[model samples]
Target: MKAILRTMGGWSQRAPTCCAVVMKHAVLWCAAMLFAALIPVVHAVAADTSLTPEASAAKMAAEHLMTAKIEWRGPSSSPKPLAGKRIAIVSCCEAADGAARASRAMVEAGKTLGWQVNVLDGRGDPQEQNKALNSAIDAKYDGIVLEFVDTTTVSDGVARALKAKIPLITLGTLRNTPDTIPDVSWDYAKHGEALANYMIWKSNGNVNALILLNTDLYVTRNGQWVGTKNVLTDPKKCKDCKVTVKEWPMANIDTQPGSIATAALQANPKINWGWCFDACMSRVSRALIASGLSSKMRGAGFDCNAESLQLIKDGQVEAVCAADPREWDAYAVIDNLNRLMQGQPTVNQGIPVRLFDKTNISTLSDYEMSHGWQGGYDFRAAYRKLWGMQK
Candidate 1:
C-alpha cells in the first residue's frame, strides 16, 4: 500500500502539465455552462424591471387620464338658448342609471334654458322606444333628443321627425347614421382604451381578463369591447396577456352577468381580472366575493355607476372609466338643438372620459361621486356660459 501510494504521488507530481491542461478545460466548461444558464435569468430580470415601449406609453397615458384635472372641453360656439322650445327625450331605459341620469339632465338643462322638456321612458324595449318617438313627434316638439336610443331601431319615427323638420339630436346613439342627426357622445372607444390602458398599467401587462359585453347594445360591441380587446390582445401593448369575451343580453343583465362571470372564472382559473362594458361590475363584484377570489382578482368597468363607485371605495373594484356627467351631457345636447333651431351649424361636443380609482376618487364631491363626474371642473357653468345665459 505504501509503495502504491508513493507511486501515485510521484505520478501526480510528474504529470503537473497534463493535470493543469485538464483543469483548465474543466473550468472553462463550467463557466460556459454558467453563462448559458444566466442568459435566461438576465433576460427575465430585464423583463421584470422594464416595460415594453407600447406598455410604457399606455401606462403613461393611463396615469395621465387617471390624474388629469377635469375641464369643459367644449362646442366653443356661444349661442343663446332658443327659448320656448319644447324638447322631448325618448330615453332608452330609465331603469338603467345612466339613461335615467341623461333624461333627468335633459329636463334640468331645458328648464335652465327656459324650454319645456318632457321625458318618455322606452323601458329598454325597441317597440316601446318607437312608440315614445312617435308620441314625441305627434306632440309637435320643436326638437327631440334620442337619449341612449339607437336610431336604427326607430327608423320610421326618425323619418317622421325628419319630415316634420323637428331637429333631432342623439344623446348616446350607438351609430351616427342618416348623416343628418348629430350625437353628443363620449368617445366610447377612447373610454375602452383608457380602461384597457389602466388594466395594463395596473397589472404590469401580465393579465388574464374576462370581459363582459352586451352584443345587443351597440356601445358595448362597437365601443368598449373593441377598445379593450384590441389593447389586451395587441402584442405591442401586452406580451403576457390574454382576454376571454362573454356576451350577456341586456334583457338578462341582472341575472346573467354574475353567472356568466362565475362560470368563466370556474372554466378558467387563470382569469385574474374582470371587466364589464358598463356598470355591470356591481353584480360582478358579488360573484368575485362569492368565489373567494375578490382579494386576488381585479375589476374594471365603464360608465361608473354609484354601486361600482362604492365598490371602488371598498377596494373591491380597481378602476372605472367614468363619463356620465348627466347635466353636462344634457346641456351639450341642448346646445346642439339650439344651434339647429337658430339655423347655426351644430358643433361636435367631444365629451372627455376620465379613469377613476382609489387614488383620485376621494377628491370627488358627494354629488360628483354619486353621478360619476370627474371632479375639479364646473361643466354646468361652462355650458351655461356657452349658451349665453346671464346666470
Candidate 2:
C-alpha cells in the first residue's frame, strides 16, 4: 500500500504523506464511481419528466392531421336502396348551422336513393322535437333520422318508434345504447384532441388555454371536455400549460359565447388561447375582435361554418377542426339505414375529420370553404360507387 501510495504521490517524503495521498486518491475514485452511477439516474429523471417527448408527439400528430389528404374511409358496401321507402328527419334546431346542413344533405342523399325524405324542424325546443318524432311515427315512415337532438328529450317517441319496428338512426348524435340504433355520430373527443394539439403545436409547449363547453350536449361532456382536459393537463405532454374550463348552457351557446369569452379574458390575462367546442367560434371571434384581442389571443373549435371560415381567412382565429362534409355525413346516415333495411349489421362508417388553418384554407374556393373540407378527394363519387348509384 505504501509503495502504491508513493507511486501515486510521485515519491512523497514521508509514510504519513503517502497515506494522505492514498486517501485523497481513494476519495476521488469513489466520487468518480458515484458520478458514473448517477449519470443514468439523471437521464432517467429527465426522460420521465421532460416535456420534449410529448410536445414532439403532439406536433407530429397535429401536423399529420392538419395536412392529411381526405378521401373515403368509410365502408365499401354495395347495398342497394329499398324501393318506395319514406324517411323523415327530426331536426333539433334549424337555427343551428350543423342541423340545417344535415337536413339539407339528408334530403339530397335521399334523392339519390330514390326515397322520399321529409324534414320536421324541432326549432330548438325539446317538446317540438318530441312532437316531430311522434308525427313521423304517425306518418308511418319507413325510417326516421334524428338530427342533433338528444335522445333523452324524445325517449318516449323513440320507444314508440322501436315499438313500431322502424329503423331509426341519428346524425351528429351518439348512440346511447349498443345495437339499438345506428348513429352517424362523430368522434368528438378526437376533434377536441385535434384542437388541443393545434394549440400545443402553435404555442410550442407553452399554452394557457380556456376551453368553452356546453354541458348539455353529450358530444361536449363525453367527448370534447374529456379529450381537451386529458391533453392540456397531462404533464408528460404539456409541462408549461394551464387549462381553464367553463360551461355554457346550450340555450345560450349561440348568443352568450362572446360575453363569456370577454369575461374569461378579462378575468385571466395570461390565457393565450380560447377554444369553443363547436361553431360558436363566430361569436367568440367577434368578441375577440371587439376586445382587440385578435392579435394577442387565438381562437379555435369545430364545425367549419361560413362565418368561421371567413374568420379563419381573415386571420382572426388560429385553426378549426372540420368533420366530414354534411353531405358525406348525410349519405353515411342513409347507408346505415340501407344496411338496416337490408337486414345487415350496421358499421361505424369511419367518418374523417381534418384541421384547417391559414396555411391551407386559402386553397379552397369560396364555395368549398363555405362547405368545409369537401372531402379531400372525390368522396361523393366514392360513396355513390359504394351504393352502386354511380352511373
TM-score of each: 0.81, 0.81
What does candidate 2's lDDT look like per residue over 12-120, in tens digits? 5546676677688999999999999999999977754564666668867777877776656788775777877999999977766766777888888888888999999
> What's model 2's TM-score?
0.81
Global lDDT of each candidate: 0.78, 0.77
Q: Candidate 1: lDDT of 358?
A: 83
Per-residue lDDT for 123-221 in model 1, tens only? 778888989999999999998889878888888899999999999889866576696788887777877788888888777788899888775566668
lDDT of 2 at 370: 75
